[model samples]
Target chain A: MDHKILQTARELIEEAGYPALTVDQVAVRAGVGKAAIYRRYASKAEMAFAATMHGQWPPPLTDAGSLYEDLLALARAFHVRMATPTARQVAPALISELAGNPDLDAQFQNTFLAAEHAALAEIIERAVGRGELAGPIDPTIAHLLLLGSLAAGLYIINLTVDDTMITELATAAAAGIAALADRHHSGNPQGATQPQ
Target chain B: MDHKILQTARELIEEAGYPALTVDQVAVRAGVGKAAIYRRYASKAEMAFAATMHGQWPPPLTDAGSLYEDLLALARAFHVRMATPTARQVAPALISELAGNPDLDAQFQNTFLAAEHAALAEIIERAVGRGELAGPIDPTIAHLLLLGSLAAGLYIINLTVDDTMITELATAAAAGIAALADRHHSGNPQGATQPQ
Candidate 1:
């Protein structure tokens, strides 16, 4: 029943939009009673939220063992998702809607953004503890800049719902992060590559 | 005349919505003849496009000498616009309506996405041509990752507005990019730097 509701909600959002969305319409479309819909979801907003996330295809996250590999994992997941057209379409509307509705904003945060940050930050924090990063480095800023470069990857490359987009973003992002860390650690640009 | 018309259109949009937008209301609010508006714009949709974009703040691009610095400039400008409470109020509705309407869609894409991407792509293209980046990098995916990462940053960081948001994003982005480059070219896990 929950799956039915989610599937129905996804169809509605893909066809129409958030403003035009209605719970009664969802119930009818799902072949369920209004009471059934209400019993599962408190409101159309709730249902919409679930439906929006229904078909998310997160890329394979590889454990490269090194901090760079870990970071690359995050970037790769982002690249694959951004490159996929289906994911690209409705996901943006969610962000645009973030400023208006606190619940939706919170949902996006709790479910997605915070987790990725935590994963990356934890890796960096561990590196700091191990004296891998410089003593003066800020974990907060590290997360910010790391994520920022990933953002830059989007504007520089056009994600046309294809594999080339994926490889290009992933490789470039990997290159960009490697360059940044090398600079941060060693004053010498040439010193960026030490024997692993 | 354009200013007055835009201000009035904004008021109407805020008070009502995209659904309620009409030239008749804009004329009455601006104390201008409807013919005056039609003289400049082909339709109400066009007028609405201008009104909504009246405050659109695209990135202030610059050749910061390096990919990292250039990326920072873009993020900082975007941050300024998004940091204001106005970003919260105006951008949400504007994006919503733009996504919903094809006419407004053209305006939004041209003014915001296309222009910004052009600025960012110039930097990436320069890097690729210079052989700093590997050949055949997809500019599209790169842009999406950049923008999507920023969108992701807003939720993850415990910040208030777009400036802090973009600033953080830019720095982390630089770091990530630098890190990736280091891994690919130098085999260094840390201490990568750019050749000045």
Candidate 2:
């Protein structure tokens, strides 16, 4: 029953686009009562996310034995997930809704973004453990770079995210993050203190 | 009359958000007929952009005598423009619409994005002339880093784009682009040819 509703929702979004989707249509098409649909999902945004995005989120981070390789794996996974026909179609609508709807935004942050952050945190931790980094650096800029660059390429410039492009972007982001971490550590005398 | 219409459009978007804005409302609020509004602007999206973004774009790109300084200036200008209340409210809607609407998307690419690309080209040209870079690097990566990072920070992470943050982002982007350019040149023997 849940699967049927989600699949129906996905089809509707793919066919008519997200802005045109509604609970009434989903209820009718899925052959479920409105009460049943509402029982499972609180709103159209929630249902849309569940159907389009919630299934394959955070995209599995693996230990590739090096910072660059790890980042490459992460980038490759992200690109694959983002490049899907369903994801591409729904992204703009979801992003726009996220900007305006605080409840849905919070849900996304807590569930989707939080999981991705945890995955990244593990990768960064591994890098630190491997002596690749001096210490844990803030991942904010790195996160922005990876997600932002991919979004820009996919949505704005219509650039195809091929393997070569993904590798180059991952390389740039890895280098940028390392440089930033190096600069931050070196710039502050207090933070620069190392055990003798 | 144009000023009144634009001002009214800006007010409506800011007050009610972009999703709720209508051409009819703008016409009524501005004390003009629908035909008058249509005469000046072809669509609601066009009117919204004119009210919010068209006024202060592509943001001035000043040559600060060096690649880092120039990038910093550009980043700063972009941050200021994007941080405005009007811009913040309208951006998600505009971006969402751009994805779905071909005419508006084409106009945006031809006018706004084209201007930004031209400005960035000049910066890269000056960097090359100054011997700061080997050759022209694809601005695609650099552009993604700049604009994508900013959008992510603003819309997703709710980051505060301060001077220090802006400087760090610029520094990272400059270093990243330089490294990519260096690699591209060194890797390509044909492109690496220099006039004796």
lDDT of 1 by residue, A1-196 (tens): 8889888887887777556778888889989999998776556655665666433533345445555455656656665554333333444445455655676667656655555556666666554564445432433444444454443233212223334333334444444444445556766643232211
TM-score of 2: 0.86
Regions of candidate 2 where Cα sits further than 4 Å from its true position? A11-21, A39-45, A156-158, A187-196, B1-4, B11-20, B29-31, B39-42, B187-196
How many residue pairs clash in each candidate at the backbone level?
63, 0
Q: Report, for every candidate in turn, its global Cα lDDT versus the true structure.
A: 0.55, 0.73
Estimated TM-score for each candidate: 0.64, 0.86
Specify the highest-lDDT model's number: 2
| Predicted candidate 1 versus true structure: per-residue lDDT over B1-196, tens digit per residue | 9889988987887777655678898999899999999886656656765666445546456566665556667666655554344434554445444445666566556666677667667877665565554432333444544554554344323246445445434544544444444444564534243211
Best by TM-score: 2
Q: Model 2, range A53-157, lDDT digits (tens) per residue?
A: 777677776678877788778878778777775666567667667777777778778887777777777777787787776666666666776666777666555
Per-residue lDDT value at B103 in model 2:
73
